[model samples]
Target chain A: MRFPRWLLSDRTGLVLLAVLMIIGIGVPALNLLVPPDHPLHLTAYTVTLLGKYLCYALLAVSIDLVWGYMGILSLGHAAFFTLGGYCFGMYMMRQIGTRGVYGDPVLPDFMVFLNWKDLPWYWHSFDMFWFAALMVMVVPGLLAFIFGWFAFRSRVSGVYLSIITQALTYALMLAFFRNEMGFGGNNGLTDFKDILGYSIHADETRIVLFVLSALALAGGYLACRWLVSTRMGRVLVAIRDSEDRTRFLGYRVEQVKTLVFTFSAMLAGVAGALYVPQVGIINPGEFAPLNSIEAVIWVAVGGRGTLVGAVVGAVLVNYSKSWLTAALPEVWLFALGGLFVAVTLLLPYGLIGLLRRRRETAS
Target chain B: MSELIFEPEAAGMHTPVAPVDATHGILLYLEGVTVSFDGFKAIDNLSLYIGDGELRCIIGPNGAGKTTMMDIITGKTKPDAGRVFFGQTIDLLKLDEPAIARIGIGRKFQKPTVIEPLTVLENLELAMSGAKRLRGLMTTRMSGEERDRISAVLDQVGLNEQAQRLAGVLAHGQKQWLEIGMLLMQEPRLLLVDEPVAGMTPAEMERTAELLKSLAGNHSVVVVEHDMGFVRSIADQVTVLHQGRVLAEGRLDELQVDPLVIEVYLGGEDAHH
Candidate 1:
């Protein structure tokens, strides 16, 4: 009845994480060390791409917290991420002021050109970085809490909950796309100068953002681990496996699922907040339903239940995406779809599942 | 061993250890408890009174409302109309399931519902973790004393040897024992078990009966079961239900001689009666 020590232990995951960290940080430093005129400078592009992948990794981990452990397959997580991005995007736009192309100190160039007179009421506090950061976590967390409170309390679950979540994201996407909404219409927000007084375009700033992304990923994973490690964690798993039994065991299954779902959405919001500044833009495109579905695929590809599998899957899939888009642009979507199908059909447990099986057999 | 067995308190601190001599009258009074699903009344104004430390068995045909009655008592289903009292003090109707469970009423469904992915030990540890919303339960792991209590209950349910096993891999009967062990860990004064012997082998059935019988002196148990033989072996009193109402109530031998009880069992032309 004794399982292998490594099967249950997080040591293997921790080791794999350490190796990935070394590569993520070391590769960027290695590229910078090369002579500026050398051909090796081309590899620096990988740093931005990898940084983006790390942000996606954080998003995947967030999705896994709800879907894998709590049995809430939210198709609206992109809404939270996009909402966070928009919050940060507002702050970034405010930093432009007179530096924008139109040279209008009070209004953004897009607004000045569009002939809007005053800022919208909701755009009041983007001047403060702290408020923007708070909104990034709180907005999504609040939305998820309200939605989940209604859905879960009404006993909505399984495929029904999934469909409703999809509808929610679609609705937000439509709302954000409107020209009158004052969120820069379809062009969205861009043209940032500084974040907390640091020149965002500088190499040192990129390194700082990259390190911040890594730290966020690590912190998110630990927070999730701490949650699932407790008695409440056991209750969530029990709920996922058999909700009726959990209820009979005197658990408020609805409350547990709602709390976890809100927490998960908040994490995804943080991911989106960090993503906007590093990439230098936030658009209506961030609200795409496909993006949320893609997050699900990342969790599925890595191994849904394993926390580290999420990070691995996100990085691996995006890396392949970047490579494919560069090498064969038209075929990238097909390849992505094919990877999803192949993983679903042949390996339901995904890549980490295969690794665990092989280790078990070898042992 | 004999001394420990004589001292019921030695069973565990959580175990119900009442004095031998007392009035020991009805502790739970379920009067006019009625529940309806859609239009049909699942429990039809059913009334039953259970005494303290009484090993009462409820026997019925399918759809006789045995599960519904247990549901009403445990706060799983609300009764549209009824009064359910615990020890002349607490009204069970006003409490939610978790609240009712905290007040020393534990329930076991027909299926063995242990936390299968967890170890048998963790399953018992979780039973002692208290209500789910209670935040501090997780920060504190089970103390050594709590562990000893869990082991004591496991020994009682004959699962001590497999304490570290994944509950998923256990034999069918062992899973049932593990669930019972979970209830025992909670140390509830009253246990409501549904179909404890169904799908069990004869040996397992015998052991389960023995376990329930041994629990009778300290704990009051209400078992809703279909198997008459199992009921005869362990039940101190048996209540027969036909449709949603009680058909007969007495010792098993007395119920066997009652013509109404016989008619309910064989499904006669006089079934409505």
Candidate 2:
């Protein structure tokens, strides 16, 4: 089949594909083929870092889809990501089976330690990988659907909507922190062993996980590209500019907002799921509202409305974050805080907007 | 054939089955419509009607409820109590803003409201007859016919040469015309235009008067305006509103002679000073 013009003609899409190809193939090759002593060898630490960035990129893109294009700034997206991680983490815990320190075939160690009698009914289908995978998308998507149905229907928007989202993530963080919630509390779920029968710590497994994360990020970007290019995307842009005007034009503002909002949550959930397997743990701390706010900063720093900007911002910001925490840890938060204020006051369109202007002048 | 604005014949774009509601003499009917915000009645027991294909100019002083009246007809505002009907069958009071638009009622805002980031042509395509639904839009392709429709509207609005330009970059008058052209893309049965000449130059106002007048027979046009000169230039029938109720209804020449309409305008001016 001939290549679709949208994928080929779009400079941003092409850039995304090139970047994904290098990471998807190149990193895995380095990890598997290079000798440990070789300075060029891709360290497991680096692979895991890149893999985590891909997950964050997916989350940032999802946030941009709503916040930038649809004008729905969701500061609670971390809740969905945490929910997804917990969903997959539950499966990870279940996979321990007889190998768990307690040697219990069915009950996870937390339940046995807590002296719970039998497995919770909610945990019934979580043992299967496919079920857990489905939950990773469904749990977040469902929560967003219900939340958006009420919020959008009532016409809550702007900073009030943003505040509500922050409240939601904070509340979830508190809920997940409770010991009786069945989900591992405080310390949360960890000590994961096998995943689909492969040792979780195996180098080959890590490489595969890294590869899958890159692929997920690529797929997420493409799906978003297709959505934003369509007529529905035009409706989103219209709603963003003048919501009441779009409504009077016969577009149901609530339905449009709901669709995009729910879809974004699911994408963030998938991102979170990938993140957990690569990072090797899931905890209530992931649900903190601050994490979602940081994700928003990434999108803002990259460029809000530009899809490629979101991906670039996510990867770049996290890379900075990792380096900063190790280098000048005392100044990381202040630097990030200052970056958001600077972007808001100066760049407005983020880094991508600056790049576009430079290219225009050059051309 | 509203969908004819696109490649209906060539691109095989899905043709929308426009629900044609038979009118019984009146194209739009409103009776005893009332709306209040914080006990201040914006529209107070308003009753109005437009005959089929009628060009009715609604003139009133500020706070005249002209905009609120249009809002009721277009389902943007729900009256505390009233009857609003499109043609004979559709009860507008029961429907939402989008459902009313789907039934072929289109409205232009007081301020020019065009989708800014989108190109002028894209703004028209979005409001074009087809691709209104999410499913249709998802699988839709821009057909040759759709291009012609956009070109036609662009020419009509005198923006044919600027079709590729972003709507946000258009001059103020051009943005108003772009919005009108966007409305025209709907091929609406009834058009509610609010203050179309608000920000236009005198020459632009004249062109807008001509443009609005030409649209009367094909679509029932209800234009709310404060420009008496522009109203006199195009109105076939005039409805004067005062304090959310009908002050007078007649030809512009006839209403100019009415004591109540004169008193309301004189009173409005007195308060301004």
List fnat, each candidate: 0.30, 0.60
Task: Compose the digit string of candidate 1's lDDT tens values, residues B36-151.
Answer: 89999888988998888899999888889988888888887899998998877678898767556666778888998887888898787767733343443344355678778987
lDDT of 2 by residue, B1-273 (tens): 212223322223334354656557788888888899899999888889898889999888888888788778877788998898887877889887877776788899999999999999889988887676556677436888888888888888889988899999999989999999988887788899998998789999998988888888888899988878888899979998888998889998888877887787834583231
Q: DockQ of each model against the real complex? A: 0.23, 0.42
Clashes of 1: 0
- List the candidate 1 regions with Cα displacement exceeding 4 Å: A1-8, A37-44, A328-334, B1-24, B129-134, B137-140, B266-273
Error of 1 at A79 (Å): 1.8
lDDT of each: 0.80, 0.86
Q: Compared with the true structure, what per-residue lDDT tens digits does model 1 show for residues A1-363?
A: 984333346775677557668866786676667666876563545566667888899899988888878778888788888888888888888887788898888788787878999887888898889999999998888888889878988999999999999999988888878878888877888888988888788776777777788878888987787677677677777787778766656566676677778888899989998898889888888888898898889888998877788888998998888788889999987887898899889888888889899999999
